[model samples]
Target: MGTITALGLLLLICMVVVGGTQGLQAWISLIFNFAALFFAMVLMAFHLSPVLVTLVTGVIVLAMTIFLGGNDSNSTMVAFYASVAVLILLVILIIPIEHWAQIQGFGQEDSEDLEGMSTILGISYLNVAVSTAILSTLGAIAEAAIAIAAGLAEILEQHPKITLKNLQGAGFKVGSQIIGTTFNTLFFGFFGGFLALFIWFAGVHYSLGEILNDKILVGEVLMVLFSMMSVIATIPLTTWAMVASERQARKKFVK
Candidate 1:
């Protein structure tokens, strides 16, 4: 087997062993998510509006990741709703940011790779950049939403009569706990993925301004920043969603 295949099998084995049935479902959801992303790319290649495709694909990915992977309906719904909210908000922000940054298309580093290839694909690179930024934030938003929602769901189960104010407090507390780790995960993942690029920058002795303005570097940085913002937004959004749900449920009970 190829290295990737082998590693994938190992991961599957570990998940199955550790997580049991839930792990298997999570793994299946991952496969579905991969298919969704592939289909999205195919649609984009066919010249569909990338932003629309991304928005649709993102919802699909989040559905599979949350609903299929988790057994709890309440938490999954909250996460899905909050994630979509964050996704929509980020899309609004990314389009203008991508346009303003003008970091779309290949950078100088990609020049060698595209020497003879046509850079004209007929699609706006800005849209693609916006899509990239939007897609990058989805995972973080979903994760944070899930974490807070699930934590609040558990609190509801335990306390059963926890006040809305206390529930909101719990949500904020859960969000604060995860924020640091999530930030670190994004930071380290970015740093590790771009370590070679950083070394190249250092070796070439790029000035501070040049490095700051580098298309590749700036694009990655902006994506990370967007993701952080989404995670931050997801916390309160998910909290409010859960609180609203509780309030609605209480009203039904009173009736």
Candidate 2:
């Protein structure tokens, strides 16, 4: 509870410093994110379309970005469109890579955690494992999109006269930085979040090769790399979109 409060306050401070316009939008975005998650869980509980639930949640996410994330409605719209493009590309890339890696569901070793969960819910542990694996990756995609949009916006603001090529180069540079930190963040987050499981592996003296080949481990690695690559890809795409939008706006004013 204390940690939550600290984070809330930290977000508030960050928003205030950034700009009231953006801050208000961010707060709204956060609220909508929670609402979407709640709705998604409700849908899941009712055994409704998991795909539909995900789609609805995704729409809500896009709406949140458009309504609460950007400086203007037009900018938000552009951001939303660009974000979708990046997400689609990322999905296309992740789908094949995940298959090539031969990763599925959780590691064979998470059975202990499954015991407590299985007792509470009569669902198959393997299904739950797969669901969780997919769920974990969703946040990465969302985060990368948001970061890409925000970075492009800042770059445009700072260099309104920047040529398209230069803008793209700047985006690549900014994206590289984002990728480095985000990848490390995801990597360490996975490491810290799954420390207990790793300890279990070590305790049981699982071979290093066995641990490396584990499905769960492979999934985590893929999620991190997928997100990293997606952000890298989004950078230039977003920069181009920003340039196009700005040029159109200027043209409108000139006319």
Models 1 onward score TM values of 0.97, 0.73
TM-score of model 2 relative to the true fold? 0.73
Which candidate ranks first by lDDT, i.e. highest? 1
Which residue pairs in candidate 2 have backbone atoms (N, alpha carbon, C) closer than 3 angstroms, thus clashing? none
Where in model 2 is the C-alpha error above 4 Å? Answer: 1-28, 65-67, 72-74, 97-106, 116-159, 250-255
Candidate 1 ranges beyond 4 A from true positions: none
**How close to the true structure is residue 60 of candidate 1, measured as C-alpha lDDT?**
85
For 164-217, candidate 2 gives per-residue lDDT tens digits of 677667767767778778878778977888788788788989898988888877
Minimal lDDT window, size 10, model 2? 122-131
- Candidate 1 residue 108 C-alpha distance from true site, Å: 0.7
**Tens digit per residue, CA lDDT, model 1, 23-76:** 888888877877887888788889999999999999988887888666689888
Top-TM-score candidate index: 1
